[model samples]
Target: MNPSKTGLSFLWLSAVAFIADLATKYLVVTRFALYESIDILPFFNLTYVRNPGAAFSFLANHSGWQKIFFIVLAILISAMLVYFLFKNNAAQKLQNAAYALIIGGALANAADRAYHGFVVDFLDFYWQDWHYPVFNVADIAICVGAGLLALDAIKNGDKKKSEKKA
Candidate 1:
């Protein structure tokens, strides 16, 4: 299959995710001082912060090595996701969208790591004093993509079970 017309058709979704992430990060970085926060609601805030490590600040306490590690991992994962997209059938809309989102989110974060050494995060949600991790558009895309994949798995599992029972 010609990837450009086949699975690669989903690249548009990837581009949307990538562009959105960068744009939001750019706005946050330009408008907010580091660690500056503005409460938007009882459970939400816009808090500018930087994450040098992976999800939930994993390995964030290290000196500086985590930046390189995350960047490299993002690149590797993005490449792998592209490969998966290329191999996937165009009719597999759910999987294609999931892969595209993961690719875009990964590449966006990698670009941030390359240019800024850390991912700019601004969206914050909390309940009282306990706050969830601050994250940005790219993180949202990655998480949504993962959730979609899990939902696809559940849907397919049911189909397989029905086919077996028949």
Candidate 2:
């Protein structure tokens, strides 16, 4: 269960995700105006959006508290991810990848909040007249990371059950 071999790949993935997320956010902010949408597919589009709150703009309606709250939360989560990455011994491939994704996403959004007082969102998908909320690279990373971790946990649990029977 030693995870030393996976550490390098984890770090590399994290770095790549973080950098790419940041770079894309930067491009969105610098290249496109806020709330602008460009069609990308039959039901997808690239949109420039800024969210001051957490996912789905929960606290976005708040005048100012959202900035401080999201910033603090991102910092706390990022710190926890770093600790888990370096200490967890049973680092299954999915778990390791999950941590990297979470770290990168957290860092990317944090940077956006610090620089623009909000997070930048661009990807947009819709069906006919119904549109989904705009999201960005960071959100994708976080969501995928959670899924990977969940899958890893289930896989490991099944393995352990089989081992006990054997």
Candidate 3:
């Protein structure tokens, strides 16, 4: 693949993820009130909530400084991801896709923070009384991206070990 095509793939994937994240957030905000929960299954529900801090609502109870901190951090990370996407080899599709997903998710959440001072979250999961933190599409993408990267790293490590023995 040419660099242009590789770059386009990254951009397209990022756009899709970003759009999905934004669209889902809009629907949740419009269709549900803050903290409103609707049962969707035996172990899941859609609950509207907002987080002004990082994952799991870390620093959410602070006096409003964490929002700015997260926004800046996201921007920095996004810039680094973009740089890596462009500098990476065209053949590295897995890495490119991983970076794209992370970039998209980071930007989506950053936009929410910039506009509303928090990220809108709705997906909720629980088993009995144990509940997971509410999250949004962006958070899901980020997690999936990180998982892919980890898998790729393990594959590469195994390949190197095998090659060394050959």
Top model number, lDDT: 1
Q: Residue 60 CA error for candidate 1 (Å)?
A: 0.7
Residues 48-127, candidate 1: write the lDDT tens digits.
99998888989989999888888888889888888888888888788888989988998999899899988899999999
Per-candidate TM vs. native? Answer: 0.94, 0.90, 0.93
Q: Candidate 1: which stretches are off by over 4 Å?
A: none
lDDT tens digits by residue: candidate 3, 59-106? 999999888899899889989888888787767777888888999999
What's the best-to-worst order under TM-score?
1, 3, 2
Question: Any residue pairs clashing in model 2, and if so which?
Answer: none
Best model number under TM-score: 1
Better of 2 and 3 by lDDT: 3
For candidate 2, the 10 contiguous residues with the lowest summed lDDT are: 1-10
- Model 2 segments more than 4 A misplaced: 1-9
| Full-model lDDT for every candidate | 0.90, 0.83, 0.89
Deviation of model 2 at 166, angstroms: 4.3
